[model samples]
Target: MSASTKPIGSARGPAGPLESRPVEDSGRRGLTDRVYEEIKALVMDHGIEPGARVGIESLARRLEVSPTPVREALARLESDGLVTKRSQAGYRATELLSVEGLVDLFDMRRLLEPRAAALAAVHATDEQLDHLETTVEGMRSHPVTGERYLVYRRFAALDQEFHDTLAAASGRPLLAQAVQRLHTHLHMFRLNTAPGDALTTVDEHDRVLRAVLRRNPDRAAEAMEQHLSGSWERHIAVMDGNPAKK
Candidate 1:
């Protein structure tokens, strides 16, 4: 049976249904950055299909920004692996991850994240643990609602912050950098989402957080491995003979 199909540890199963609210942007970022994030959101929410052309003029008109910022935003997205630039065709939304790419991504994550978790258990300060707690709280505070797209967006950001904090807690800059480069959670959101998936994710995170709080390196590593492995299986199951399926 698939790992995702297997029950997550009984202690860390899904909680009650999530009741998410619309994700609120604080409007703190500069215009260029905001434009970049908005366009990126369009791609991630599948508002723009994989491999479809991204017309800068149209985007600029919609966003009410100059074409310069739109072009700049596309260039930045290209670096994030979400946009691709064809030699003569300008930019298009990048294709979703292939099965092989998914395997490779999880493989690299398996190698790096567990080690980071183990180190985090050994080195995390009280302040770092509190920061981790804050991120998890954010996830739990917003339950899934009718705003599925917004729910996914909020969950993905919180998830990224959670992992990024965990990696930083390792006190090894290079190791943390490696984990950040994977962009595991961001890409995973691009794959598929089911109703209970967010709750399951929070439960899995709680396990890791508990282990870390106890400063148990072995348990922390084990929990991290299970989390990543479960995520892999869930994403793989959503593949309907394509990189991603709605």
Candidate 2:
């Protein structure tokens, strides 16, 4: 998940020296972010056996950057309930994200997203619809990258954009803000483990767009639920793939 990746469109200087400029520092935040996103993305993408301990130093060294940002990113992941720190294990990814956890997340999305879409149906601009449609389209051609086992990092970015649009289309500042938080957390899960289960997701998003555009609240809600349910079953299958040890 680490690269001394140059800023967008910037030519890589001699590979030996990792540049450290204030402007570069601003850009390094981008790397730091990529570091975080990549690791988390790997978690979802690779389905790293949950509860497997991951070493920050190892990851930092592997990514080819300073450990400071990696530390910061891991802490943030801890806050999100995705990664945890144990006394001896250092930081390990959570393997068994419970079925209860999955069902709860789906419930929240079901309750909130439909309302948001219904609002958006009336309030959304044609421009917003066009923008969302574009983002949805981008997901189709997206590619996977980052550390081992976890590749959902790319799709995670796409999912975030889509839900944010869904909220913005609603045009209710308060609701959008609230939904944004939930969506962020939801994206964390959906994106984290999306790689292995993407075909189901592609079909899912296709249906969502069709329904949302039609401005059918019931249909949009149903589509969202169906998509998430498929995801939950996939995760449950993943969980069963490594049945609980006695």
What does candidate 1's lDDT look like per residue over 1-246, in tens digits?
321112222112232111122223345246667678777766766566677788888776666667877788899888778888989888888777888888899999999999999999999999999999998888887644432344567777888899999999999999999988777766777766544677888889999999999999999999999999888877787775453343
Give the Cα-based TM-score of candidate 1 against the true structure. 0.81
Q: Give candidate 1's error at residue 78 in angstroms.
A: 2.6
**Quality of model 2 by C-alpha lDDT:** 0.62
Lowest lDDT sum, 10 consecutive residues, model 2, at 8-17
**Candidate of highest lDDT:** 1
TM-score of each: 0.81, 0.64
User: How many clashes (backbone N, Cα, C below 3 Å) per candidate?
Assistant: 6, 11
- Residue-wise lDDT of candidate 2 within 1-246, one digit each (tens)? 322222211321121112232112346678777677656644543333355666777666656767887888888778656678988768876644455655676677677777777677677788888887887787776743332223444566676777788788888998888776664443335323535556566678778777778878677767777876776676666655755511
Flag regions of model 1 displaced more than 4 Å.
1-29, 86-89, 146-148, 240-246
For model 2, the stretches where C-alpha displacement exceeds 4 angstroms are: 1-27, 41-64, 75-81, 84-95, 143-150, 183-197, 244-246
